[model samples]
Target: NEQISKYAVQDPELEGMGTTCVVVMLKEKEVFFAHAGDSRLYLLRNGKLAPLTKDHSRVQEMIEKGEITPQEVLSHPERSLITRALGMENVLEPEIGQSFEAGNGDKLLLCSDGLYNMLSNSILEQILTENAAAQDKAIRLVQRAKDAGGYDNISVQVIEFQFKEQKIILPTTPLNFFEKNIDESSENISPTIPKVVKEKKIVDEEKVPKSEVKNTFQPKPEMSEKTPPAVKTGKKVPDIALIVLLVLFGVVLTLFFLGSGMTKDPKPSELNISQTPDTNAVAEPMNEEPLDNQQETTAITTPKKDEKPVTKPEKPKKIPKDTLISYTVQAGDNLRKIAQRFNMKTETLKKLNRLDDNEIKTDQKLKIKVRTVHTVAAGDVLSRIADQYKTNRELIKKANDMTDNATKRGTKLIIPLAKAE
Candidate 1:
């Protein structure tokens, strides 16, 4: 069947473009499928078959509400039309895949409407009931659709779930290790985060296969509270370097001020430089004596010698309290580098300016402390992005006014977070 879009239900720019999608996720015996548009998912378990996800098109909705029969939907003008898309809206609420348990000998079928449109449910059931393998079933479904006049793009996925003996290893402290890595994976590792994981002897290392020893766990998109573990690379943290630099600065300052104290006084002959220009200068240097420790009378004069001792310069006071903090965006400028220079975080800078990303062009004026902006980069997730600025993900959501945790690559973000610890 030809897919057609009515003028009223079409985007002006992309009016006639339409396609179908079908995806599957297998978690052991359980399977999940998320779909959009007019794609379909089917399950054949225990000699029984049923449709999993409902189509998002007008024909399917009418069929569900008993407004149309199966025969009428096959010849409808809008039979192959799409009512939903992935990148067509500001807020995308994708239909979640329903999870179902698969028996030892269960088969799943994912296909576009091209296959199911021409074949009856009874005929499809008989084909699946013949105990065909996944590959054979997929091939047969494709052949049936082609034989019945393949009028559109056709795709199918046939999956079979079977039991296999695999060794499972349990972690000793999943939560603690998970949290510690989460903290260390950011800008700096907090001292409170443990350096190493405690060992467990329950799972023998030699017996466990090398492929089974997985230390990382992937985070689900729907999960807002959970975060993935940080992959360790033995890199030094910025806080450690900051501490070292501070100590070095302190030592230098101390030596400079202390060396100035002993220069308060000068020798009498050394001070009388003009009197003995030539002959006395050579002989007087040898005749100079060290100052005596004991004296009946104490010398309390303020100016001991002709030369004055050096004094520290007073700090500037003409500039009043800063009324506003300002920053000028230079060429190739971004919020992250600017924040780092000022010892602030990107989230903090974004909040001050009410911005979402580091999208400022050259010659743009950014309110350095008044608002914050952050650009989402690759390998960046909500939890890790929040941790880098010393804040939790919840605060970031509130500042950006977003409930969805999904952030795209190169997306500009706001960081209003302060140092939590």
Candidate 2:
């Protein structure tokens, strides 16, 4: 309203010129709406048409106060006299309707008073309930309203909710023993039992004697009484040969140590020096070169001072910048929607378009800042794409005007990069 008042102050012609406003936002399974004046929102579900908003008109107030009935609202003398509307006052308060749960095959209708004023609820319901596309229904409604009287401007917007069906999968049952080709004896045994138990059972059955298997009892073995017992000798003998060998080894070791100590070390003067370079030997003489000749050799090996040093060339750096593109406002488009489409804030969009409020009209041209374009490929997701571009998922979604994280293959998307500080 402050924006509107400012506009009105700038241009006197805009003074007292107000309009109705109605906005509907659709989500995965919910619907939200806000409105001012007589433009309304309706929902059609399961062939039942229900109004989601009430008008801020004098006839509506009268009906609420019991001075008139809802059926008479169409014919009331002050039916067009709205109690509230955009630009009607310095302060504007739009009725923000509560969000409601949405379902598959639901149809939402948003139209100006011009539509409901000509067509009754029954007529509107009958048309919306027909099996037709949202566009067709909107066209039919407008045509019918024009046919009725065409007393005012007609504007209609139709939105259809489509939800993907969910498929339930049941758990599978285990195969029977016959189908699994398992032995009947093994079927009764628990799978958790250790393999050692089965192996031990087989060994015990094999080791059982035939007589013991037939009878339930077995006798213990005993030695015969006449059997003779062997006895061990109690006398101890010394190892004389081992002692004699130990004495011989000690005498030999003592003789070996005494012989090693008796040996004398060789003196350093008696050491051999056959391979050493003898200083006493005569030295060979060589021809000496001139100082000038040596200087010439050094000059030949030196590089020229005029040669320039080699250095690598530097590559140019490319700085990223924001790009501006034109966008045409389509049906159901608003300033907020356009802002999101370009991955920008609403205030930024408003500032770019120099709009003082959120109001926008169909077919209006908008300027959008796009960093680049990306063609979605197979296995592409919002998060992965955002990471690849060094951005965020929300920014990508807003730039592409996507409500969900789903991305279609081969779809061209506008990537909006944030401005560098």
Candidate 3:
């Protein structure tokens, strides 16, 4: 991204092509973008409008350096003057970031400063929230910007994303009707999706066992006349009839006795009498002796309330000491200015160096705190160490008290994240 900007700056043919550039890339619901100049990228997510990129303008620099308040930027004379842009210099450093998580119903709107300068964030949010297509939104935003006395170039790019419902519809046919695809097992398919169950006939015969099937019909041999009088048939019917009459008389007497017993209306003595207990009768009884065994098992499984397991206390993290280095005071350098240059609090420098005030003279040696120190190992080089810690070789050498020479193996150095100019 920087290479293209560098080329544009160096090429003579692109002298008139110096302008702000903003490029946005969307990846897996995440939004990333690189921006330079006064162009802006705004996000409307969850009914809130937020700017994703900051303009590389003079007012922005003033705001960063604490020279002016953010509220002043809107009316500042140099609000439109950008400090950084492609083709403006031999090198360009655009602000790029991927911290925004874009999701459904999220709108990403990219536009030049013309649109933002005329419309407030609330107005932009309302426009973006309207139920309209992206192309129509972009055109409406441009037209709105033009309507608001916008003489500068007006450009708009709107991106709106939404989630769609997923549904798996089954074929409207019975399992047997789809005979061609039945050989495949139904269980292997996705459980979330509806599937047709295969009929028993579609199942391969080899896969089914034959023993599960049973036959219910059987043929019987006809009775023959030659097998005559198996038991002498009706010849003994007279004797059986006399025996049946005697049995019938005895059944009638027994039935009459039972009817008289039921019609007796249960005598008071008989109703009051309880059923007599038989001494010979025996009953199984439940044994509760295993209750003690259950209690023992519970004791074995559960921990004792009185005795708790001991846990060791974790060791506290040690605060690393900052490396103390000397800073040679330069022209226009004071304690405050030097502290600001190093991104340090002014009072911290004063307390660390035992300085009474911000007053300091040129060429005076001042003590500065370097945040980290690293010892050189085998195959370690100054450049490699700088890259490892995101520092430069000159600062490392200065912090380590070395000259402009390559550091040897086993040498120790301090990596100063911030140093005085």
- lDDT by residue (tens digit), candidate 3, 1-421: 2354456448633322357777675544455566667777777777876666666655565565566676565544334445556544334445554545555567788888767766666667778887766676777777676576554567788877554332222234332332456568565544221222111121111221111111221112123443232232222337875665566445334433443334222211111110111111122223332311333234344558998766689884332444344454655567876675454678888876667877665435456665554544445567877776666777665544455546543233546665443
Residue 291's C-alpha lDDT in candidate 1? 30
Query: Which has the greatest lDDT?
Result: 2
Candidate scoring better on TM-score of 1 and 3: 3
> Which pairs of residues clash in candidate 2, taking residues 3 or more apart in a chain or in different chains?
none
Cα lDDT of model 2 by residue, 104-192, tens digit: 56778898866765676667778887766667777888878767644456789787654434332222322231236456556564433
In model 3, how large is the Cα lDDT of residue 208? 15
Model 1 segments more than 4 A misplaced: 1-18, 64-66, 164-421
Quality of model 3 by C-alpha lDDT: 0.52
The true-structure Cα RMSD of candidate 3 reads: 42.2
**Each model's TM-score, in the order given?**
0.35, 0.38, 0.37
RMSD each, Å: 32.6, 46.4, 42.2
TM-score of 1: 0.35
The clash count of every prediction, one per candidate, is 18, 0, 0
Q: Best-fitting candidate, measured by TM-score?
A: 2
The models' CA-based lDDT, in order, is 0.47, 0.54, 0.52
